[model samples]
Target: MLEEIFREYDIRGIYERDLNETSVKAIGLNLGREMLKRGAKNVSVGYDARLSAEDIFGWLVSGLNAAGIDVFDIGLLPTPVGYFSVFNDKFDANIMITGSHNPKEYNGFKITIFKDSYFGADLQKLKDEAVSTIKAKTQIKDDFRAIKFDIASEYKKFIIYQFAHLKNMKLKIVMDCANGAVGAVLPEICKSLNLDAEILYPNPDGNFPNHHPDPSEEKNLKDIKEALKGEFEIGFGFDGDGDRIAVLTKNRNIKGDELAYLYSLVMKNPRVLGEVKCSQNMYDEIDKNGGKSFMGKTGHSNIKKAMKELNIDMAAEVSGHIFFKERYFGFDDALYAMFRVLELVQKGINLDAELEKLPKVFSTDEIKVETSESKKFKIIEALKLELAKGVKELPEVKEIIDIDGVRVRFEDGWALVRASNTTPVIVTRFEAKSEELVKKLQSIFMNLLDSIKKGM
Candidate 1:
């Protein structure tokens, strides 16, 4: 078992290379034991459309059963549906086997113990236990001992009923499923709602022949954007496991923070949570609109934990992970977010018009600098120290927010440099009042980061 697979948020790595039968079974066994310690009796397991999903599922189940925990196989489904199974009170714990917008050869597990995300320190503990005690030649069982469950159908019905109001709504929209797990249920839900929608790449293909299953990249939304050029009023694109979303109009691709701003328009005094990478405009706009905005760390697990602690109604990441607690479960679901966007449209709220009202600020998309996992956090620490000492080349510092990494607030804008919890990369973003300022801030920050990297 490679320790690198035990990430801050979840366990992920290349199949066979790091997540083969022996390693995956060991992970399942250890994870099952931890679940039992927490008083979890049974876990609902689901997988995405990854080619190795079935093989991994079998191995994982064998290990879980060896740990004396019951397993409910929810079959192929989106990550959100797996979350819904837990929130629906059908299982004590849940594990979704998905690559989650990663390359097809990669796969991983996203775990939920009851409603809480099983991550961070707990994940580290699991790693320690696996490394110290678990054996390399763990026995594999032929029988999976898993009971088949149709949670996907249940989740689809629940969604359809929840958004029954959108039935036969006169709105034209297009969806790009990216050939991931969302294809399993979204089309059926759309049909049941009688939505005038066109769905592209609805078939679940682990190969992802259409485009990469990530909608956050501008290139992936090309087909959907091209469809929007016709009579389609809106476009929605989804990532592999159907958790993240990209909302696009004829003019703009609405990001997660921007989506939160739009969702808050109809909400009364909404309590919204945003991550460090969110634009300054998002925070200021929400605050100015009678809503309370709070910044938290950048992972879904971090955001969800913060939401529970802060009693927040909504939370969003700029990369399209939006969570809601106002009227539904506070888990990130792109399908659920799609309905909410439809609700906004149903209320006659023009999506593009509402966005245009926000203060125009130039912002750069997340810029990632490749680095080794061991050096990423060290670089972040060095950058923070340098900023604290006040580098002359940098702009005047208003404040340094170290909630996650380092978000340096400037007089005109902000610059952020943080280590990606999942990947071996340093993530950076900059926002300013003008394009020129944005470029300048990015240049200075990158230069400082380069110096820090060189010194290390």
Candidate 2:
């Protein structure tokens, strides 16, 4: 029973090792009890392509049933589909069993209740309850069976209708499903809309034999790039649970913030929200286009909450998590975002050309420094203290945003260093007007982080 599995964003850990039957059943029972306390009577459950997903579902349902919570099983589907079921079916709660972009040995649960993601304090409470139950050695007996329901077709139909204008766009499209949850729905949806797309790894393989399910890594995108080089005008890649997306032009990979910028061009008075990690150009461009722009804390849960509270039309993270509330539900759906991107191209908006038009700035991909989960946050705090002490010696700080992590703003660019909530590492990113400036900022921050971690 590793308590560390209960993460900030979701409950995740190595399968069998940390997410054994005992821990998982405890999680399910605690979650069910918590949902009931929140006035939730029923929950729609789903899983990704992982082989253990079905087994985990069985164990999870037992715990839920023991707590007298009705379970509506959507079987194997993307995480977003579980979110979709909650809205379209009016389910009181929803849970998606997925590892997301993590490796094969990892698995976890993403939970939602009353339209709000069950995270942060909710997760902490659940963890505490589960640990208490285990300590008390409570035996929960299963009482009810799960009811099977299919939401894939309905979700696909809804997406097709939402973006019907993109039907038969005749653009050569290539998609890499990465053998994740997208295999079951993405192809059929594309076919229904008459999209000329070539799908790679359309089959759902939990092993992910072709490549890793995460498309954010450049190495995992090699297949998609290969296909793009051979007659594909555009490429799309999805994470393990089909929530995050990686958009690719023939020549370049389009990032989430850039995608928001492109989407804003077609929208009338768009209100876009981006994470602190987003580029300054995205914020400036949205404001320049008569739209509202806001920078919020990084993380899907944080972005979603801000979007709902502020009535934001769209939100994005630099890591390719794009949420749309303009004409669709306010959730990060890669499949839906793909259509929006195609809609831009279908409506004569040049994909690459539009991106090229944005002010050019050099940026680094998310750089991770390995550290223990226990030490990661401590390192960040130490670095923060050091930065404050050395403020006079460092480059002039225009502004420092500590919404999620520490984002130091310089006149020319900015640098961010934060502890990754999902992994045992410190995530960092830097951007500046020139490559040299970006490197300089990153070096200073890296040195600070290294010294702090060593001290710890």
Candidate 3:
């Protein structure tokens, strides 16, 4: 029932403490009422491999039925399959019950209304209603009134058919599912396509017995990287809900922005979008190739919104949320991204060689500065004002992009400082043409941020 559970992206928190049966039911009721206000009648619902998912699903369905909304249960599946239901089956809305790469103890909902992300202010309003209007004494029983829907098989069939050309192509690939929801469908699709693939942790285990389901951290990719040392020519790692992907070659871990750059090479006048944390080389490379590139706010929902608003062909986040509007739905799908990577390889594009062709730049991974949720955005605002006054130790600022956070552009590179919308931290990254400059930028930015935090 805590207000902090309602994040900018979706409703998420520790399963029992913040998202209990009472609170989840309230959320479902409020969400259903909101949909009713928008004239939405029925919704498709799916849950991930979390242990608490089934219990939460029943509570949610009870509340949704109370609001006179019909539910189509898609059962255990990846988050993207829930999204697919809306596009393919023409549902009014969809809700995926997933923690999405968070710890095993966490669980929540990712909602899509009319094919658009139901997030940000809309989610905040639902929080207000759910907390204030609903009382504990309100007798809401666990009356599950959901009809069964088999969207998983349809989704797998769609993928296998789309990638039929790559069937038996003699490509040795390694995949690490991390015991997440992707295991529900990916292995079967690979087998159907006759792909010579080795899938690690292909069973859906809510306990996450192997490792954390997140692929963004290099530590989590240890097994896949080790497997690639022998016969595996390429490797892929997927997050819990199967919406984010980490692609690897023998020599390099191709980031989402880099993947966007690679995908653009095959398109005619490709218009691509990247988040604020993306390296400058990604933008520069796309422009150099006679394509257009743009920078937008970070987060999967924000990226998808920008893609649709700009009619972009593709979009990517540095953390591996890649969306394609060129040939498929404009939603982040790690499963689809894997096939796209295979398509690039099949077309004779050398993944590592294409990456090597780009201009070299030194960059640091996302550096998180721990701060209270109440103070994170304040720190960002204070730092922005301080930089506007011109810090003596920092380099001359060429431009300041504040679309999501403050990305201060310099002559050689840039430094980004943004407050994470989902967690209580400020995310920072630095990129420069040389290692020395990268260090200098990081040091200066950290000092400035420290000063601002102290002042606050």
Candidate 4:
């Protein structure tokens, strides 16, 4: 019944194999029913530049039609634009077909309901309904009407109008789109802003022939950085869906915490929120600036919901999901983030200079420890048991925060080990005051992990 692809957040799997015509159609029907049951009148849909996205869309349309939901087709746009549809056209729900950072072989859907993310139990409910209906041989209408929607232009105009002041700033910016859906909307926005922008792999190539569509990895920025030989001021990179962003200065890529710190300085009395993965500097800077800060679990949906619950105006995750309720709608829009940086530059701020002021710390980019799907959680559980039992035995770990998973805060800095909610791996990152401390922490954690694995 295609339950394998239905994850805690969204539906994702390989093309034609895990997400074929039958399974996808059934999944769409389930989403449509969920929309109807939740009292949504229509759903807006968009997709990335994947070869199979075109055909898979047809199956999705069929399911929406069967559920009697009107379809507004905004073809080949970013997920953020799909998110905009719910607000732009007053639609009840939005769905984006994208594999996100995954390779060309993968494709999936990210869903939103009434502006909030549709995930967790909500996702499970859809899977259950899809499977049960398949078992019962349920009946649904086979027809759906999709009208071409010009959301890209409208979204572009909105962004340009909002940041019209940054136009003609004469600040050169290099962008790497990774041949994803941003190809349709990003360049237009940049043009409107009068940004001296140079784009790499801007065309919508589903194959991603150059590299995978993930900017979080520093290696992925190789070409873009090399292109920045002279003083380009900054560089911007986008993921497949264009909701995640990687901000770069001339010297180094700025993590999400760095962005929050800069933004907090500009935003008056800003209430900032950073996910557990965010650097400690973000929180410290916000506190120093007389602004309040809070920490939450990582995930775009989780952060969005947290923003609403805690009345936070802005939020950021290490993966570069930036949500702004400060002045506009609360959602992660990478295109918008690019312009905001331009405005910051216009205000006589240098991104790298600001970051250099912070105390230096040693950190590692996210290290993914691959494990089997069935064994990932078991490993975490066993490790948790060891930590709890030998709290005094292991003097290295001073604190254990299992808010999302386990984030151990130490005196020097901190280390985190969390089972990825979206992937079958233990995602880890460590930050310390010195390089030696970072290595010490990483070794300590890895040794514990190896020990636990060997039943030592």
Candidate 5:
């Protein structure tokens, strides 16, 4: 059941079947056993606002307790809260029960050991170890420490204190929770700051009846934008797990890189890291502002890990996984991100003005081409080889950057082909300083990818 359900980034499956009690329990036991071996005694657990979370939490804790591991229950939180629990307490291991932006019927896990992401390869290793020990059922503890602790208060207080001047900022704001987990803390944070705001879908419900919980998709944000009625200066939307976020102004929808440029302005020499998927304008803007910018791989875990190594103040993905090592914990928190934007507003700066100043470029919003899960990575390997041959055989290419996947930069534009780490798709994006040039680049890349699909 575990193997069949495992995805590249997280484990997810249908409840009561693919994610049955026995398999999930065994997963918990294996995870707990691994944590113990790694010298972790106390571990923190949190869950999203899913209907299945209550039962999943119970079964998951039961298995962990069976392995003689101590568990801290952080009830009904965004995925980021589980990360916060690791830093807030002395504990080193954390587990978040969530399927992130997937459908409401879906649910799964995002885990970390000693504040490091237990992702991708590590996740598979855990499943493999559990499967190898099919008979490894330890004694289940009669009672475990399932305590309710309030973390939002301190998190709210920290941001409020950080932006103390925003107490009476007197700016109208609109937030679209999309019926996800962000509903728990954002309103409290906004209220504490005395920031006037209207919230849509503030109640934490798993069904997500108002709209799909993904904010990155433009169509999904229609209700939230319409709700604003051009009365609010800023808007925020969060995915189901709350790790990913999106921003909206009256005129335009701001991407993560745009937020980074606007947010980093208040600081002096702020070092920022961005993913390979970010628009070139974001990197150029950071450089122009006397700040440092590093283009790295995409993934919250990867971006967060890169921040520590690079000692960067902030990091963002095109999909809006914003991390702030500036004034708070170096994790992606949408509630905190909203306050940061409010703080920017309080300073009398325009939200879209910063983006407006940047040199305009035409870019794609992450085009995904579906491939067989087994063939996707191997096809990426084949594509990489093909790129190497094309560069050597063709004269049009100026440079190729294969740090994550492959990015070919021509004189007029650039095109990227990368396999998404989380899902079964080869992600592609194109950009150019001119709209017409961008369209040309897109056509070229699309034709090539189409031919590749046919050949494969």
Candidate 6:
């Protein structure tokens, strides 16, 4: 097994080649042993719609059983529901086997222990254990005390009951499940609410025969945009495991920070947390409305953890990961966020009009620069050092926020360059008051980054 599979967030890799039976089994064994050491007796396990999910599940269970832990299988479900099972069903720990928005060949686990997500340093420890040790060849017993639980149905019922006020909405809505695990619960919730909606790719197909599960890319949103032209008033798209969302109208493709601003209007004394990649307008808008805004590091885990610590009402990333601690749980859930957005429509708020009211600014979507995994972080460090030394070719900088990556604040705008923890790429984004300034800022950074990489 390759060490690269052990990432900052979770364990992810190509099936069989990197995460073979032995590696996965060793992972389960190590995790089970760790959980048992923490006094965990029962653990909830769920998988996404990936083709190799079941086979991996079987192997993982064997290791868990070898470590003497009981597995409560929730079968196929979204990542949020698997997280919800820990709180609602009182499971000691939960593991969701999903790839989030990655391609079909990728699969990983998002682990939760006693309501706190097991990530960062905890994941690193698990990786150390899994990699250093060898798998035992002894034949383990079958029937690893697996119990089937219906978390999906229960989760669906909870959502429907929570948003019962939205029942029988007259708005024409469209949903694209992307043939991922959202198919399991989205239709049921919408149906029970009597929503006038059309569901696309409602079946959980591992092949993803329709389009790629990631909604962040413009190409993946073609189907939903087509349905929105004349028939549907609004459209919602979900990622593979259904934690992130993409909201689209006929005139605009709403982003996460924009959604945060819209949601803040309905909140009382709201306190929202946004990542560094979020636009300054979002922070300025929240401040204008007598609400507090805090900028934190990127990533769902980082955002969620900061929210709880600060007692923030909501948190959002530019990539459509919305977390609400105002009324619901503190984790990111696309279905839950969908209901919140729909509630705005139920209140007669025009989606496009409300967005247009915000201060206009030019922003670029996340642009990735290819680099080796070994050099990604080094490049960021090099850029930061160069910025500190004050290069002549670069634009005048107000300040630099090095929380997640290097976010250089120019007098008129800001540019960000960060190392992607999950991929071998440097993610960069820029925002400015004008389109011309935006391009100039981007070019300056691109040239500086190129020069730095060449020297390295």
The list of candidate 6 runs beyond 4 A from truth reads 135-144
lDDT of 4 by residue, 1-456 (tens): 276688777889998988876777788888888898888988888899998998788888888887778888989988999998886755789999999998788899999988889988888888888888778876655565798888888888888889888878787788999998898887787777777889888898898888888998878888778877786768899998899999887688888888988888788888999988888888988988899999998888788888999999888988888888976688998888777777788898888888999988889989888776667777788878877776453336667888777788877889888888877888889998989888877887888777766772
Q: What is candidate 4's TM-score against the reference?
A: 0.96
Cα deviation of 233 in candidate 2 (Å)?
0.5
lDDT of each: 0.92, 0.88, 0.91, 0.84, 0.80, 0.89
Question: Candidate 1 residues 168-281, lDDT tens each?
Answer: 999899999999999999999999999999999999999999999999899999998899899999999999999999999999999999999999999999999999999888
Per model, state how many residue pairs clash.
0, 0, 0, 0, 0, 0
lDDT ranking of the models: 1, 3, 6, 2, 4, 5
Where model 5 places Cα greater than 4 Å from the true spot, the runs are 135-145, 391-395
> Quick one: how many clashes does candidate 6 have?
0
Give RMSD to native, each candidate. 1.1, 1.3, 1.0, 1.7, 2.3, 1.4
Clashes of 2: 0
Question: For residues 332-431, what per-residue lDDT tens digits would candidate 5 score against the true structure?
Answer: 8877787788778778888777678787788877888898777777777777777766734233888888878878887766888888776678999988
Who wins the lDDT comparison? 1
Candidate 3: clashing pairs of residues? none
Q: Candidate 2 on 21-100: residue-level lDDT in tens?
A: 78878888989988998899999999999878876887788889878888998888989999999878558899999999
lDDT for model 4, on a 0 to 1 scale? 0.84
**Candidate 2 local lDDT, residue 233:** 93
Model 3 misplacement above 4 A: 135-137
Q: Which ten residues in a row have the lowest lDDT in candidate 5?
A: 137-146
Which whole-number lDDT from 0 to 100 does residue 88 have in model 3? Answer: 84
